[model samples]
Structure formats: structure tokens, C-alpha cells
Target: MSQQPKSSDDENQTEMYIRVKRNKTTYFLQCLPSEKVLQIKEKLQVLIDEPVNNQRLILIQTGEVLDDSKSLADQKVENDAAVALTLRKADNEFEDVNVVKPDDYIRDGDGGSNW
Candidate 1:
């Protein structure tokens, strides 16, 4: 009987461990090497407080941002890979409530202090 050659997928489907560093915390996750980055992000959303959309996962070894369309295998994310997590700032988040500006010093055309 003839046997078919094994595909790379077969070789890469093995489960692996990935470490995530976020917010001064380290999280360890078990996952398949072939799992999509989106899937990993979904899981991360569950484990971490941040939403997936706001989270940026960086493969520490490769220094590449994990894309939603690519799989860990495609990124060559090996077993025990370390991923760094960065949170995307929302438009309103962390805004300076009282920012000083040069314009603030200038008075309006109206002499009455346009406070």
C-alpha cells in the first residue's frame, strides 16, 4: 500500500505554549501552532480585560505584529513563543483634561475675557 506524504499542516498542527506580556503581567496560554491570530486574540480577550480590537500582539522573537488574517504557523510562531501585548488608545481615553496652550493665553477679539 502506498502512503501519501505528510503535509506541513500536519506537522504544524501540534499544540504549543505561548507567553504573553501585558500590563506588567505575564499570561501563559496553550494553543495549536496553526491557530489563527484572530483566534488567539479572541482567547486573549477572554483572559485579559482589554478587548481584542484594542489589543496589539507582537511576536517578540520576530518583532512582527500578528495579523488577524494570518495563522501562528504562518508567522512561524514556535513553541514557547513570547508575545507582547499593547493596548490601542481610544480617541477619548487618557486625554489631558487641562492642557495648556499658547492660544489659551491670547484674548479673543472681544476685550471681555472670553473664558
Candidate 2:
């Protein structure tokens, strides 16, 4: 089917495509320049199952991370811009105490074991 060409005014009003890359996957996200960085992360979370807090979007050309407090327009992000996706590591400092050993338990006067 043939489609009519969009007018310049219509084109200006339409959302632009932002290419997102993660490993070998590429996602073309429709974004408005006025949208906040956090909004973009929220969109990515729904599309790719990436947690919003864990996502780190970097500009492919400049390697600059998108600031959560700024709008896309503030960064001068234009249409058809490419972004690389990275994930923040989970909290590895948490000690897993699920498997308690005998040595980990101390006996009190009442003969009760305490962790």
C-alpha cells in the first residue's frame, strides 16, 4: 500500500526514533524531545524488562550517560540518535544468611540457639 508523505508540520509533531542497543538486540523507541530521562527508562523497562534504577543509557557518539534529572531536549538529543544500554550491578555487599551453620549459632543460658 502507498502512503502519503507527511507534511513538515506533521513531522515536527510526531515522536522521533531513538535507537537503543543492548548486546545484540536493537530497539527503536519513539520518544519526544521534551520527555525526561526517567520517562525513557520507564519505557525501556516495559519493553525490555530492565529495571528503571538499573538502566544506564549512554550516548553512542559521546559516551555520556543520560541524567535522570534532565529532559532529552536539554541534552540536545536529536531524532534517530543511538544509545547504548548498560545495567547497574546489583547490591553484592549483602551477605546471604539463608543457610545458617552450626558455628553461626550461639547457645544461651536457656539452651536456645541464636544467630
lDDT of 2 by residue, 42-90 (tens): 9999998968887888787787888988978788778999887777656
TM-score of each: 0.67, 0.65
Candidate 2 wrong stretches, greater than 4 Å: 1-14, 91-115
lDDT of each model, Cα atoms only? Answer: 0.76, 0.76
What is candidate 2's CA lDDT for residue 72? 80
In angstroms, how far off is 104's CA in candidate 2? 51
* Per-candidate count of clashing residue pairs (backbone under 3 Å): 0, 0
What are the per-model C-alpha RMSD values against the true structure? 15.4, 16.1
lDDT computed for candidate 1? 0.76
- Number of residue pairs clashing in candidate 1, backbone atoms closer than 3 angstroms, sequence gap of 3 or more or interchain: 0
* Per-residue lDDT of candidate 1, residues 44-98 (tens digit): 8998767778777888777788898898888988899888877777673432222
